[model samples]
Target: MRPCPSPLRPLLLGVAFAAISPTALLAQQTAPIVLDEITLQAATATGTIAAPAQPYAGGQVSTRTRLGALGDVDVQSAPFRAAAYTEELIRNQQARTLADVTRNDPSVRQDAPAFSERDSFFIRGFSVPNLDTLYDGLPYIANPRRSALEGIGRVDLLMGPTALANGGVGRVGGTINMIPKRAEDQDLTRVTTGIASDSQLWTHVDLGRRFGPRKEWGVRGNLSWRGGDTALDNNNAEVGVAALGLDYRGDALRATLDLNASKQDLDAPTSLFNAAAPGVPIPDAPDGDINTANPFEFHDSTHRMIAGRVEYDLAPATTVYGAFGASRYREDFLTSNYTITAPNGDAINELGFNPQEIEGRTAEIGLRTEATTGPVRHRITLSAAYALNRNNRGEFNPRLLGFPVAGTNIYDPVYLPAAPDLSGLPRADGLIPFADLRSRSVALSDTMSLDDDRVQLTFGGRWQEIRTRGFNTRPGIPDFPVGEQNYLYEDSAFTPAIAASWRIRDGLTVYGNYVEALTEGPMAPSVAENAGELFPAVVNRQREVGLKYDLGTVTLGASLFEIRQPNGITDPASNVFSLSGQQRNRGLELSAAGAPMEGLRILGGVTLMDAELRRTQDGAFDGNDVPGVPRTAASLYAEYDLPSVQGLTLNGRVMHGGSTWYDQANTQKVSGWTRLDLGARYAVEAQGREIELRANVENVLDESYWASSARGFLAAGAPRTYAVSASMKF
Candidate 1:
């Protein structure tokens, strides 16, 4: 039972105010229209501004999320489905952090980790390694870092086949591009402070300025710092991020240069617990509790990135755009007291020492152009890229301490005595430090519009080649025993899309589109020394059909999609050292967003999915559900503003996720759960400036469930939480 501000009173007062305000002002009165009105109308008609370009067809949500929209589409009139997490949305939602903002988007999901170092997420059912993340259109080559979502100007999430343009390195679900805040006219500064459920204090600041005669070239920057400890006894986190950018937009050409840097340190102390044996009932404590008796591991680490882009208009109708980005990352990671369950259901303990350091660099360059020649419209784009990554690991072993009870911090190291009792202890005899890889790709695409401009068609493809070389510092390391390992792998695939739109009536346009896209080749094998090592890549092919309806104030869409990954390479069930074969994901989605009624805004979406593994070395899994992928998911958000009040609004939302499997065996399952959130805001005028106050509560039902399950571990979901914030604008 959650209580929200009553909804009916605002509507009634709003209507009455709308009816009376105008007349009351008229009574106090003004001058009548005269000869001046005629001249004003004529001048206004001749000096009208051109509309912004239509955004390309498809969904684009982030600046770093490389979908065709970022470089190809006009942002003015194209009918594509997109949800921008703009500053206004962030403020209205009272989203205090980055993770908080993602909770509102139906297509994106975050899997909370019991231990902070376990890795967080902003994705759809895909194993996107943390190393693949990007910042301001550049890959963060260093260790990934988490930042406050508040300082972001906007976040773009481009969905579907648009993946083809991003060098094809992710899940088909979608891509996220976070556009940080840039400088604007007038000096602006903001400070935010908050507290989490774990009783940790958090604060961040953002500043922007545009000084000079015309403010043509401006400066923008942000600084965020946060530190806190969790309910889990030994866990804690510290993070800091700073960014600055310069912008110059002249009459004919525009350019921007920016720099971003961040550092994160986490004392992610985590405890490991084994589920009770098959015959024993699973233990259940109070609704929301952390397991503190288990022996734990502690993790400490740091990450950084530097990057920039330039755009020039060659002519009134033609423009050339190019971008160059480079980044480097270095990290030293270590783990202690790692534990796992043995086959017999007993707990096995090991000291996990990962005293390894990794450093790598990623670079890319690309060009784009578009123009219209009479009845024929053409768009052309070409890109060339090079990337290299290297990892050096040495003197690490995975056996050491005893496993403790749940949630506890206890260490019991294993020792070998005079008689050599080292049966289960890790051996330090064979250690290696070596693995380097390099890859390059070239892509070209052209889209032509014909048939009276109502019918549009596009055909594009990419040719990519990858070369790898690996070496081991130690002998007997399987594939590269005391020598260099080299391999050359190449792949070429074409992405073709066809879409059409018809103007059925005024203010209404209907459209449909179909796209065939593909992801690149295989991935590097895990760095585990072993035998019968098999490395194979996976291919994803998808076909989708959807309908979109737009009527100015409202937009509606529905899509049905099927994706098949033939020869999907995966780790073998028997050992984590080898690989195995195919999987498929098929689904349907429906969504709508708009201001259906005056002063009211709404966004709703639902998805029905079927994901599975078709075949494997173990046997045929034709009907088994894919692990970690939801069968059904839904979300809804609605807000209403009171017209009578200068600034007052109410907001509410609900999100739900259906059942999902936890592993390939399909023996463990997580049931569905629903969440509710509610909030409101009020504005006050003080000393000629306006200030807004907001309050919100999440998970009103206080439901307890597994928010995310991965590899073989599960993280508990957060319980009910409430927050309040205040902001001022000048």
Candidate 2:
């Protein structure tokens, strides 16, 4: 691990002072504040505006979520598989990003290097891009690579395609949505300070207040900063974040506005490695905390976003809502790529730099109405969504003997000399337009309730249109009109979904659903025989059946699902890319959450999947397991409050995955691994202020292993690391 720096002392001291000052100020006030009463009354109220659901008994997970157009629904009533992690869970675990919050989910696997600029995940045997994530029902605000959590209130994960719910242009795996924090009716002031392994230090402040008569106006703000050496040798990271939210509530109208800005810088970021040579045996993973990239290799990113929403009740049974959001993101990075050349950890490395910028806007409008027709109650919704994204990018690459850099051994790392000078090489000083995309969709849905709301049925459909154009941004290439570029792909599809749920008893529900999804097709690469050929959009079909039981304090769910989609592949002999194959994934999932006993809480599940490649180019790889998918995976997390010590809790988690193949032929493989994490938290009253301290250790066994194989590459699991934090509220 890297050594701590001298600057960390002042940051820690400042955090401590910030936390204590609030307490002193509160004491000086002439009127004593009754916090418990204010908090309880605010929590019990239900308003027209949407808010995150309360945490379960243990405060680790939530029972309700706003999933797509379904609005806020309890897990037991929704006819699908999903999970919502609450803000309380994030704070207790000190989670920094989405990856940290979803670590205990059995159906998801992260597919990126720990310190890399990008974060990717595979869900239910399919890849889910960060761009697909939504923020408050609008897409394009959450950064796919590294999204800050300071402004987020809840993280919700929905399994399966979201075409009917979120519209087209999504993956079959699922969708992730982040709900921004909103100010409550009560006043709050909190401060937190934390340190991680290898001397990383961080501090954050959160404040919320409601003003005006009847507390109709609310405001909340958060600010945070972290800088120091990371767990990896010679690697360091710095991050800064600021967020603000404002809202208004009235008898007929509700409105909210949110703004955020963040920046991240990493020195010596981890590099990605390709699969080993076909003939050579796969090499063992290197030390988990080793840094192989040169010190100069770094990544820097900045992002800004703003979003607002408003809802008005036209009548007691009718409502209208609208939302608009926009974001701008920029990234500059220089990194090395490594490829194993021999079984003994020999590899070749290359250096390159890329600078890119993206701007996007998204909007939504909807109307909902409810009525009762004699014995049947009906709820109907009509909505439309629109989004636009534009990207600009530039790169610099200097080749040496056909390779970007010299070769080195992975086991015994050796840093390369200074990068070759690129002054003579042609450089693109300014970014050029790379791609532009526009998406529009309209949806209609209805839910019918019968037998005093004991039986419910829902059906929906969406008409989606996607238009995309690409450009040749190469510096020396002859420039052409933006719309006249060689690549232009446009398509439209109408997808449908139907679901039904029956109440078997007071606490158990049985449900099933059939849904379809559509994804943009791939364009053949220039090297392919049918280069530039644009294929038709790919369609995915899914069917699922599940059972959910809510026993007051414990929730249990089980699901079985199957998803099938067309697979595109390149023929070796013809050098042509086409949709010549099919892929299918069938799986079963079991999950449980909430407190089973008075003091013991559990949140986790197991997933068993069978993913296969079928109808390949020549049937050569038919019946083979899909690359990067594990057959069996399980995760378990438990927390217990000690009866001997008030306000003291102990928690632990375990995760395991089965072996996975790296190639379609199944020749290269990575063994499965298990990891353990443990932590403890204690709360107490200090000087009339509530203070809490927490400490956690991940990878407690210090085992080094390969975490996953996705996109034909391997990622190393995180090493043993410690985190300690202290927070005070007034």
Candidate 3:
């Protein structure tokens, strides 16, 4: 076995916690506070608002502890599979980007080379464009961004079988929701600046204020900017984002509104596969300053989102909440001077392509109510969603030659223009430069629970319908060829779920859930006479069993899961294959996070899966492991506050993934590799103000590996790099 790369200042924090005692840590917090007893009277319920007779665990961070479910509820509690990424974890790791938070999730996999476009992610073996981007529980889809994390308070990842709670039409993989920062009491603010090993620099500011009786009305805002070069030659990315929000809370109701916007630019370098030569590195480019004119390129995009939520109480045990959100995204990409190598590794550039633009929008609204009666609890929700997506692309498909139009000489480069229709091909009159689509969905779910203070049983059902329409034709070229289709005649589906949990103790619980979910994909363009031939809907069914263990100071969780789909999409339609078959994914996952001891926190997880295509027309992939998904993956991250030095902490993490095939044929493969990161932070408080200094080293050992590879391109992971940052808070 390869030696574990030791992080700076060694020792995982968990290892140190076992050596300490709770009393030693409890001493850090003030002695348990005791309150004086006094005569108390029942507060009268106000007009039209529901009031609780007692307090609820609304502040519990564990509710949103998974990936994306947004603090709304636990995956086991929701009508569908969901995960929440809490704020504590994000702050501790100094996560600067959306992709950073997912590195440790067993259900979410970031493709390859952390920052690549295709480097996005996959859930349950299906490629997702960054886990169903959402804003305040609404779809927040966008091409890609650099500082997307800065605009979010937390992220909720909802996995497969979500056709109900999240609306109808969506990817088979899952969805993601962005929980924006809300107003808080106290004049709190934080500013942090840092530089990475790749010479990148970043700065961020978060501020919140409260000024009113009840402190019920307040404002919060954030600003972030980062720029720098990475280990990859000619590869660099930068971004800026700003967000503001307002909140109002009253005796019977609470409301909030938020607006956020951001922009990102990237200069992507070509990612080479295999050795540049017999002994050269995979990213064969020379170590020097590179320019756009080189055999590489990149572009930019803009994102904007707006959302609001309102909660009202109707009775002592009932409360109703409503949420609405919307977002817009724009993208432009270009490629020139790329190198197309032959199967023999000989240089060739017989191809070139460019994306003039790609843009889309998403909007959603939902209403939900929570009620309780004695030992029973119930929450019902209704929602509507719509999305508009369009892409105008251009590619040069030269026969016998690949892209980069492979120049005979390695020292020479070629430039290409945006010619999508191959300067006019046969049969298909006019260039098919674009495809447009509009999708709308409506859904509802109801969750009913019964508990005897120790055991809880939950039942829920979701009903949904998806309708989509397609169009084609560019602005100037109104006569352009465009394929149109619809799901108007498709059937609406109802998926039901049941779950039971037994609490053995305060910190441990065992849960078993059986759920069924469904989804519909965007219709692909029709190239044949039958316009509806390629527009069929896809659906899935999944069941899972899991255990939850919270040790107060540390939490441990494990789950055994099985998922299957009766029908899916099969690519390369020319092969005459049908998708009316079954696919399955069975896996075991373990995750833990919390303060193991005073000033020490550790987060780690691992997943082992057996995913496969059980049946298909081709029958070739029946028993083979699903391509592009790892069989086993693991991650470990920890941070320790120093004992001798006040306000200082050390952090480190290592992530590993097993290898898998790249295609259905299983003939080609991408090897597995591990990456390491190390960092530290020092804080000082003085005269009503605070300052922090931080730094991190990424790819500490500079291991070379392919981040991702597909039919047309490959991306490499960054090599060794260092960054430093500083921030102040008031």
In order of listing, the candidates' clash counts read 31, 0, 43
In what order do the candidates fall by lDDT, top score first?
Answer: 2, 3, 1
The 10-residue segment of model 3 with minimum total lDDT is: 47-56
Of candidate 2, the 10-residue stretch with the lowest lDDT total is: 38-47
Q: Residue 220, candidate 3: how far off, in angstroms?
A: 1.5
Runs in model 2 deviating more than 4 A are 1-13, 16-48, 395-403, 420-429, 475-484, 522-536, 568-580
lDDT of 2 by residue, 441-468 (tens): 9999887778977899999988888887
Per-residue alpha-carbon lDDT of candidate 3 for residues 1-730, written as tens digits (9 for 90 to 100): 1122223112322322321233322232213222243211122221111111111121113453222111244433333344566665566566766667877576676654454443366676666664355555554343333337665666666666655555454565566656666666567766565656465556677788877887888788877666667655556766667789888788668788888777666676443332121222223322222222333456556766667767665543335556665555555544333332433333443332333344456565555554444445545555566655544443322222233343443223333444233333221121333444455665555455555435666555556554433343323323533332322334456776676676777767787777666555533322112222334455577777778776756667787878886534324224222454576888888887767778777776888888786776568567776656778878888788899999998989888867766545465566777889898987776555566666777778777665444221344565677766555565
Clashes of 3: 43
lDDT against the true structure, each candidate: 0.51, 0.77, 0.55
List TM-scores for all candidates, in order. 0.77, 0.91, 0.77
Taking the tens digit of each residue's C-alpha lDDT, what string does model 1 give over 614-686? Answer: 7666675556777667877788888888888868988899998887765566765666778888888887665
